[model samples]
Target chain A: MSERAQEGRTAEGPTAGEGRTAGGGHGTGGGPGRVLVAVYGVFALAAGARAAVQIARQFDEAPLAYTLSAFAAAVYLLLAVALGRGMRRLALVACGIELAGVLIVGTLSLVDPEAFPKATVWSGFGSGYVFIPLVLPVLGLYWLSRRR
Target chain B: MIGPLATGLIVFALVIALASLLTTALNKSMGTVLLVALGVLEIGLLVQAGFVVAALAAGEGPTDTATLIGYTAGTVVIPPVAAFWGVGERSRWGPAVIAVAGFAIPGMVGRMLQIWQGMG
Candidate 1:
């Protein structure tokens, strides 16, 4: 009987928390949106580190690609912060830029291979990064809309 | 960088990630099991980070020190931050966040191994 009661309390915990968070106007900073923010934060670190290393060590190797990586990193970092802070407008703008960036870069990388001697995060729809770069912004926008 | 440690951490991380996903799917919130598992993963990563840093200090490791160090830093930091963020949620998504960290740890560790091997 005690064990069953413990299990009941454990299961009841999350549902109550979820409702309070959703109704609290936390927007993009609550519930499943929290997961989205974490993913974005990880991507931000990954992209930023990649860009930092490339720019620091071999800027001359592929200036255009490296520069684009830096730009992508900035955007990701911005989106992560905006969403976490519940700044909808900034998050929306960041997501829009990210979606546009990946589609454009993914298409360009395939259509003009030589033009991109090196890969940016968005190359081939983020094929190089498991395509999370491709899917993340869409998820961000969707989660934001749903939360709103 | 001990080759076996990276491989072991990869295995451990994936297991934790899968378990976290299972918790989420079951509609369960974050529990002591996930936190303890994450703690174990964090300790393992810290051990690896110590070795890598020691190797670097001894004038060893890949020529691409910056990237390798970056990966090391990422691996060490991600878990605790995930725990902090996940714990605050008190929902199924809490475990989901931990799951993301679990998945990311292996990728970074694998990359760090590759870098240490001078492969990439």
Candidate 2:
């Protein structure tokens, strides 16, 4: 049955095949790259909406955490768009910043928990998110370098 | 909002995620079984959403109704989109996309449960 779906995709797979065949289109679209884009898109939407609500509802309760959430959300959005467009340089920069942000925020949250009265997406290396926030940048960096 | 139903959906999503992940690990594309499983999950999620909406209308659910509804709507949408995108790719990552969506559904549903309880 899966074979039927596989055949269906091949029957209409110009975009997928073109993603690989089209020169200089490594990052924008392809097999693994498409997965990455999808993951990033989900994260962007999740994080962005979370930050918006947190900030709008009670910014004073945890301004730092909410702001950082907003920042992380923006980064995820940029990374998703940059990767989808195959903007290698921008994607690289975004991945680097994300790595740095997670590390810094993770450490800070651990050392001075009071600073984050509420949890941001990066808090505790995204433990609330099953640590994907910590791991995604590492994967992104590896994927980007491999593409280059 | 519905206790056992929420747990059932979460477990169902988790199982689907694990199956999809297994396919990706084996370097196989998503199969018909997985697609059908996803469709079923989506339908279950919609049913869950309907229940949540009905509960909210009766003023028996979370105080953060907006967020709860957002999560419910988002959860219902992920599976079909992932399936559509997954079928487009012919590689292991095609299943990888489904795996991600499968994982996301449980996570989102869990959050919705938490919101319904006002645990956040």
Candidate 3:
């Protein structure tokens, strides 16, 4: 997808009335865009699976934390979709939400360790995942903004 | 949890990651050589997995079976996934993806070993 397409721009390029693409337009065979989609897909799978397992294994132990994990995973999936479909507005929203989630969760987990009896994907700023959770949002936002 | 073999793998992965990062920084894309290196790394991981399984069969396994298996399996998955994504771009980011995957392997492996040793 072209950079304009990534920003949810119409054929006229960044003009008004360009409805967000329902899905990413990235699977066009081969390119940097496809590679980005693939990486996002990997994160989607990892976060989704991890959250599912956490929720399944012990939802009662820490409902908030696990639910947050699920939420983060959902956001990641959405971000992947947005980027893939070249839905710039949706991608921007999702990436913004991701950044917010990481910051909020990161702060809360640090402030009150007891609240997070179990670690979520964003706990300790995603220390468990080697801080990629924290870093990914920044990259996503940068990628999106560059198109704008 | 921190065996020599596992450590060796982690270090090797880190080295590869550094190489990838440097290459990508230089605007170089992942090419045939890097792809072959990744393949070789995958083969090495499979061999390591086989060794671990054999050791377990001999009753010298790590403490946690399931987590150990999960880690072992995870290590094997990273390279191909990265390569699949990496090859398509043909840009510096292609190798960047490889770098990320390469770095992740050692950390995951180390964590798995820790779990196996009942440390985590």
Most lDDT-accurate candidate: 1
Candidates in order, TM-scores: namely: 0.91, 0.87, 0.76
Candidate 1, superposed: residue stretches over 4 Å from native: A1-25
DockQ of 2: 0.29
Candidate 2: CAPRI quality band:
acceptable
State the TM-score for model 3. 0.76
- What's model 3's lDDT at A50? 61
Q: Write the per-residue lDDT of candidate 3 for residues A1-148, one digit (tens) a residue.
A: 3653333222122322222233322322123444455556666656666667667666798898888878887887787677767777887888888888888889999999999988888889989877888988887776665555
lDDT of each prediction vs. the true structure?
Answer: 0.86, 0.83, 0.71
- Which stretches of model 2 miss by more than 4 angstroms? A1-25
Candidate of highest DockQ:
1
Model 1 residue A65 lDDT score: 91
Candidate 2 lDDT at A129 equals 88
Backbone clashes in model 3, listed as residue pairs: A23-A85, A24-A84, A24-A85, A25-A84, A25-A85
lDDT of 3 at A121: 81
Query: What is the DockQ for all candidates, taken in turn?
Result: 0.50, 0.29, 0.15
